[model samples]
Target: MNDKLDLKSTDITSLNIEKIAALFPNCVTETAEGKRIDFDLLKQELSTEIVEGNKERYRLEWPGKREAIVTANLPTTKTLRPVREDSVDFDTTENLYIEGDNLEVLKILQESYLGKIKMIYIDPPYNTGKDFVYKDNFAKAGNEELLESGQKDEYNQKLVVNPETSGRYHSDWLSMMYPRLKLARNLLTEDGVIFISIDDNEVHNLRKICDEIFGEGNFVANIVWQKKYGPANDAQGMSDTHEHIILYAKNISFWNPILLKRDEKQLAAYKNPDNDPRGVWRASDLSVRTFSENCYFPITGPNGQIHWPPESTSWRISETKFNELLNDNRITFGVAGTARPMQKKFLTEVKDGITPQTWWHREFAADTKIARYEMKDLIPENVFDTPKPSLLIKRCIEISSREGLILDFFSGSATTAHAVMQLNAEDGGNRKYIMVQVPELTTEKSQANKVGYKNICEIGKERIRRAAQKIKESLNQDSQDGKGLNQDSQDLFNLGNQENQANPGSDNVQANPGSNIDLGFRVYRLDSSNMQEVYYKPQEYNQATLDLFADNVKPDRTAEDLLTQIMLDWGLPLSLKIERKTIAGKEVFSVAGDSLYACFDHELDEAFAKEIAKEKPLRIVFRDNGFKDDTAKENVRQLLKQLSPQTEMRVV
Candidate 1:
C-alpha cells in the first residue's frame, strides 16, 4: 500500500500539453532541461503547406506576449478556502460565489470544471485607463507576491491600477487578460460559447486575442448593444451610446444559439384579416433582387390588372410554386384587391420565436439607467456605477445556454447571478452560475462604504440575497393569484427531489415541492494550499525540523480546508453537498452523500473506521496523524478493506 501523502495540486496546463503529446509524439520534443513543444514540427504535421519563420502572419502581438504565454503555463501552489459564514445556504445551493483574484480562481477550477461550463459571460475591465488590472509576478510565487504587494486586505486579493500614462499600459492589461481567458476556455463544453462585454477602448484588442485563443473560425458575432437612450450633448466628438459584446464558441459547428422570444410588438404585425383557419398571418414581399428566368412571367391581379416584378427584380418563387401557393390561398393582395401581389405568412408556420438579432435595442435589453435603478431598488442607499441590467444578461443567458452551467468571473455587483435567478423564475430553468470577483475595496467616502459594504464582493453577495427574496416573493404572489408553479417548475422540483434522494445526506435543506427555485450559493475564497510548504519541499527542512513536523497540514488549517483540497485533487465540484455526521461519536464528513467519506479526528481507532466502512462509501480519506499509532492505522486499513472491498481509501 502507498503510505506517503500526495499534497501537490494538479498542473492543468502541463496536463494539456501532455494530452497533445499523446496524440502527436513527434510534435512534442524535450529540451536539455525539460519537455517542450516542437512548434515547427507541429505546424508541419497540422498543415499540408508550411510557412517559414519571420514571415508575415495574421496575428496579434504585444510587448509582453511571450511573458503572457509563460504566465499561463506556470502552475500555482494554491487552493480554494471554503468560507461558510460568508455564504448563503452553503450546504444546499448549486451556485458558487468565489471571492478572489479571478486568474488564480480559474486555475484552481481547471480540474473540477474542465469542459463542463455551458456558457461564460464576463464584463472585464474595459481598459479605459482607470480600471484596476491585476499584475502577476512570474518570478515569485503567487502567495509570496500577494503578501509582499500588501494588496491583501481581509479578503486576500490584490488590485493595481493600469493608467494610460504607464509605458506598458496596453501590455499590462493584455497580459492580465491573456492567461485568464486561456484558462476560461478550458472550462467550456464543446458546444459552449462566451460573451465578453467591452467598450470602444479595447474591443479591437479583445477580439484579436479571442480569435487567437478560441480560433478565428469560431467567431460568432459582435453584438452592438444600445446602452444609452439620450446622447451626451457635451461630447468630445461623437456621443457614445452603445457597447459591444464579443462572442466566440468553443466549436462553431457544435454550437447553435437559441432563438429569442418575440415581443408583443413583433407579434402585433400578424393579423387574421381573412379569419384564415391557419391563424394570424402577416404579408411578406413576393419579389426578390435575384433574377430568375423561370420566375419572369407576369401575373394578373384580382382586378384584371397586370402585376409584373419590380424593376430589376424577379418573383421570389418559380411559376409552379407561385401557382401552388395561389391555389392554396397563400398569396394575397391589398384590401382593394388591385395592389401588388404578396405572400401570406401564417404565424403557426414560422418558428416558435424570432432569430436573435445582432443589434440589441435599449427597450428590450434594458439600458444602463435601468441597471442603476435596479441596484437602487435593491440597496436604496448605495449603487454600483456601471452594473449591466439583468435583462441584458438574461438575453445572453437565453441565447447561449438553456439549463446548463453559466459562469461570470468578473461578476461585479453580481448582476449575472441576479439575472440567472430572474431568468430561472421566468422560464423555470435550473441553470446554475459561478460568480468570481476580487473583493475590491469600496472607497471610504463612497456610498457603498457609508451603507456598510466594505468591498465589491459584499455588494455582490447581498444582491443575490435580495434578488432571490424578490423572486420568491413574486412567485408566492403568483401562486396566491391562482397561478401556482408551472409544469416546468414542477418538473424541475421533481428533478431536485430525485437528486436529493440519490444523495441522501448531501443536502441539509430540501427544496419545497411547490417551489423550484435555487437562490443560494456557496462561498469559497482563494488561499495557499492546506499542506505546509515544507511538506512538498522536505529537502529544505533539517532533520530536527522534520522530526518535529508530526503533521504535514498547516496548524491553522481546519478539517474543511483539507476536505476542499481533497475535493480539488479529486476533480470534484466545490459546490458538491457536504454533510457532517457522527460515527462512534467521531464526526465524519459525508461528501456528496457517500461519494466520499472522511474523518480528520486525531487518535482515530479501528472501530470508528469499521463503522464508517459499514456505510460502504465510494471513497474514504483520513489524516495520517489522526491515528494513535502505526498498529492502529494498519488495523483500520485491513478492517476497511475486508468490510468495504470496493471503497478506495487515501490519507492527507
Candidate 2:
C-alpha cells in the first residue's frame, strides 16, 4: 500500500522488445546499454533464405522517418488534468475535448482507448507551405548555441510554417504525419476504418504512408469529393474543384460498410403506372446479350402481337420460366401492349441497400463553403479559416460506424464532436467521441482574439456547446411538429434501444434507452505529472528525511489531479463518472459503483478502511503517507484483506 504508482505512458520500444524476446530468447542479447535483438539471429528465425542488407525492396522513406518511428515508441510523463469550468457535465459526458499536442495526447490515450475506437476522421493540415506543421519537441537553446546554429531565437517553436522553398518541405510534412498515424493505428478496432480528408497537395504522399501504416491490402477506396461549385479567379493553370477522402480499414476482410439509404432521385427511378400489388416497380430488359438454346423463344404481348429479341440477342429466361412469370404477371410491355416483353423489377424485392460510389458531389457530402458558413452561424466571425461541415463528418460517421467511440485527433473546429451529437439526436444512437486538438493560440490581430477566444481550443469548445444547444432545439421543434427524426432515423443500428457498455479499461458511461441526447463533453488539458521531484545527495540530506515516509506530491495539485493520474496509470478511463463521498471524515472517490475506490485525503485510518471495505470494490487506492505510520498502513492492508479478499489494494 505504500509503494508509488507507475506514472508514465507505455514504452512501445520496450514492449516490442519483450514481445520479441518471448518468441526467441536466444536472439535477445544483453548489452552494456540494454537488451537488444541480434539481427543475424532474428533474420534466420524469420526467413528460410539467406538475408542480405543490400537487397532492393519497395518502400517509401525520407529524412526523419526513423526519428518519427522512435518518437512514436518513446514514453511520456505528461498527464491530463480535468478542466471542470470548461466542460459541460464534467462527470457524466462520454464525449471528450482534449487540449494539447495531439502526439502526447495520443500516447496518454494509448492505454485507456486501445483498440476501442470504431471510427476516425481527421482533416489534418494539407501542408500547402503556409500551414504550420507540428515541429514535435521544442528545445530552449542558449544564446551561444543559437548563434552557432545561425538561428534567430531560442529553441525552435512547436509549430513552424513550412515554405515550399525549404529544402525538406515534403520530408518535414511526411515525418509529422508518420508518427501520428502510427500511434493512431493502435486505437482502431478490428473492423474499424479511417477517413482522412486531403487535397491534391499531399494526397499521394498521404496514400503512400497510409499504405505503410494501415496495410496496403486494407485500402478501401479513394473518394473524390466536389468541394467547389465554381472556379476561383486567381487560378494557377487550373482551378481545383475537388478533394479526396482516403479510406482504409484495419482489416479489409472484416470491413462492413453501412449502405446509404436511397435518396428521392434514386427512388424516382421506380414507379408503377399500372399499379402493381407488389408496390412501385421498374421494368428490366427481358432480353439477354448471350444466345442460349433454351432462352431464344419469342414472346406474345397482351394485344396478340409477336415480339422478337433484339438483333443476335435472346430471351433472358427459358420458355417454361417465361410462362411461369407471365402467369404471375411479372412481365410487362408498352402501355399499348404492342412492344417487346420486359420483366417487372419490384422496389420491395431489393435485399441490398444502395452501395456508395467513389464519387461524392457537394450536394451529398457538402463543401468547404458550407463548412465556413456553419462556423459563421455559431461564431459570427471568420475566426477559423478552415472548418469541415458537420454534415460531411456525419457522412463518414454513418458509413464507417453507427455507434461506439469515434476519434478525431486533428479536430480543427471540433466538427466531429458536433456531428456526433447531431447524428445521435437524429438516429438516437449513443455514439461517444473524443476530439484532440492542439491549443495553438489565435493570432493577436484576429477576430477570434477580439471575441475573447484565446486559442483554437476555445473556438472548438464553444462550437461544441453551441452546436449541442442548436441540435437539441431542432430536435425539440421536430418532435413538437410531429416530425420526430428525419427519414434516415431508420438507419441499421440505433444503440439507444439497448445498454451500451464500454470495456477493457472500464470507461463505461451506461448509456441506455430513453436517455436524453449526450450533448455534454468532458474537457481535459495536458500538463506535466503531478508528482514532485526531490533532488538530494548523501552529503546534502539525511536518508531518513528522504525515505518513503515523506510526501512527494506537489502542494499545488488537488486530490482530483492525483486521482486523474492514478486513473491513467491504473488503466482506468478518464470518462468514468466519479462519485465523491466523505466516509468517516475522509473524502472517498468511487467510480462505477464498486469498480474502483480511492481516498487521497491524509490520515486514512481503520474507520475509513472499514467503511470502504464494506463495499469490497474491485480496486482501491490510498495516498502514500496518508496513515499515521507503517503499522497503521500494514494493519489497514491486512484488515482489508481479511474483509474484502478480492479487492486489489495499492497506494500512490
Which lDDT values do the candidates have, in the order given?
Answer: 0.83, 0.80
Strongest candidate by lDDT: 1
Relative to the true structure, candidate 1 reaches a TM of 0.85
lDDT by residue (tens digit), candidate 2, 38-58? 777788789989787545569
Number of the top TM-score candidate: 1
Residue 596, model 1: Cα distance from true site in angstroms: 0.6
Model 2 reaches what TM-score against the true structure? 0.80
Q: List the residue pairs that clash in candidate 2.
A: none
**lDDT measured at residue 56 in model 1 versus the true structure, 0 to 100:** 62
Question: Which lDDT tens digits does candidate 1 get at residues 1-652?
Answer: 9999798899786787789899898776444334567777778778888757456677886667788888888787789888889788888898999988888889889899999999999999878788888878768745787786557666666677777756466677888899999999999999999999999988999999999999999999999998877689997899999999999999999998898776557788999878889999999999999888888889998899999999998998988999999999998987789878999999999998888889987655767766776777778875589899887898899988779899999999999999888777777678999999998988889989988998899999999998888778767766666443232233333343342332111111122336577888898888888988777899999989988888889999999989998998888998788999999888899989889998999888888877888899999999988998999999999998999999998988
